[model samples]
Target: MSDILVLYYSQGGAVRDMAQLIARGIDSVPDMRARLRTVPKVSANCEATEPEIPATGAPYVELKDLEECVGLALGSPTRFGNMAAPMKYFLDGTTSLWLKGALIGKPAAVFTSTGSQHGGNESTLLTMMLPLLHHGMLIVGLPYSEPALASTTSGGTPYGASHIGGASDDRPITEDERKLCIALGKRLAITAAKLVA
Candidate 1:
């Protein structure tokens, strides 16, 4: 089975849940599996360091995960309409992969969780695609055909999947949001499989 990397950074856990939902969608495609990974939190203090392994949730992502995966599903929480600092920090370190054209022709997708209706979910998703695009990834988005994209009262977008996690970050993934996440994953896997075939 080929693996699709589900890489994400989560502070309050909503993004992590979205990652899992996307992975489930990827795994639903035959012969496709999800490789869940996370990035370490960036320390505010320059001297502080994260452990080699995280205390819980997905393991830290390595550059190798990017080269080895058939596709990618990137997720993060919105920070002022942008991806969280840790995720951006991790992406910034992938120059070596970029130099080698390691991700060229691969299919990619993005997902995010935000604190409110206009909390930059779309902007964050669009910005997250920039790095992937620079790596030569083919962006896969949720088309209007997905009924949830039209009916969603909470979060869903053609740019990708998203969730509105309330002010306290306690809101559960709505039914539409869940469906969109899975659809994005499935769509990415299928696109990658076709590209590699």
Candidate 2:
């Protein structure tokens, strides 16, 4: 079976929920499986370090995860129109994989969550694609054919799946948002399967 890595960093749980939805979508394809992983939180003090394993949620991602996966679905909460620091920090450590072209030609997609309606969800998804582009991965997106892209009042986007988490960051993912997330994952998995075959 081929694995699609669903890697994400979420502060308010919205992105995490989206990641799970995406995983479900990936698993919809025959012979495809989802591998969920997350990054450790970043600390202000450079000397501070997180435990070897997280206390809860998914385990911290390892570089081996990238090397082994057939496809990738990256997600993060928006941080001023960019990916969160933890996710960025994790990507920064991927130079070894970059040098080896470990991710080249693999299918990839992005997702995000934001505080407001215009809280940089699209920008964050776009920005998240930049690194994948540099890695020579094929970027996948939710096409307009997905009805959720046109109908979502909360968080689906052509760039990728997203969520509007309100000011307090407590809003749950809407049905449309969830559908888009699954669509994005299924799309990536299907693309990966085709490419692998």
Candidate 3:
């Protein structure tokens, strides 16, 4: 079975839940498996550091994961309409991969959770794609054909999957958002499988 990397940096747990949903979708496809991973939180104090292993949740992503995965689904909570610093920090360290064109031709998709309906869901997803694009990966996105995209009052977009987590990070992923996230993952997995075939 081919592996698809489902990498994410989530603070409030909403993005993490979305990642799991996406992984489920990827795993649903024949001969495809989801490899869940997460980035460590970035600290403002230069001397501060996270433990080598997280106390819980997915492992810290390694460069090898990027090198080995057939496809990628990236997720993060929005920080002022952009990806959070931790996720960006992790991507910044991928210069070695970029130099070698390691991610070239692979399928990639982005997802994000924001504080409100207009709180940078689409913008965050768009910005997250830039680095993947720079790495020469093909961007995979949701299509309007997904009924949830048209019906979602919460968070669903053609750009990618998204969630409106509310100001207090309390809102749940709506049914439409859940469906779209799964659809994006399934679509990305299928595309990657076809490319490698």
TM-score of each prediction:
0.97, 0.97, 0.98
RMSD of 1: 1.1
Per-residue accuracy of model 3 over 63-140 as CA lDDT, tens digit each: 999999999999999999999988888898899999999999999999999999899999999999999999999999
- Residue-level lDDT tens digits of model 2 in 1-197: 99999999888788898999999999999999999999988786532267988889888899999999999999999999999888898898899999999999999999998999999999999999999999999999989999988988999888889999998889878899989999999999999999999
Residue 32 in candidate 1, Cα distance off native in Å: 0.7
Candidate 2 at 82: error in angstroms?
0.2
| CA lDDT, every model vs. true structure | 0.94, 0.93, 0.94
Q: How does model 3 score by TM-score?
A: 0.98
Pairs that clash in candidate 3: none
Superposed by TM-score, candidate 3 places the C-alpha of residue 84 at a distance from the truth, in angstroms, of: 0.2
Instruction: For each of the candidates, give the backbone clash count.
Output: 0, 0, 0
Better of 2 and 3 by lDDT: 3
User: Candidate 1's residue-wise lDDT over 61-177, tens digit each?
Assistant: 999999999999999999999998889988988999999999999999999999999999999999999999999999999999999999999999999999999999999999999
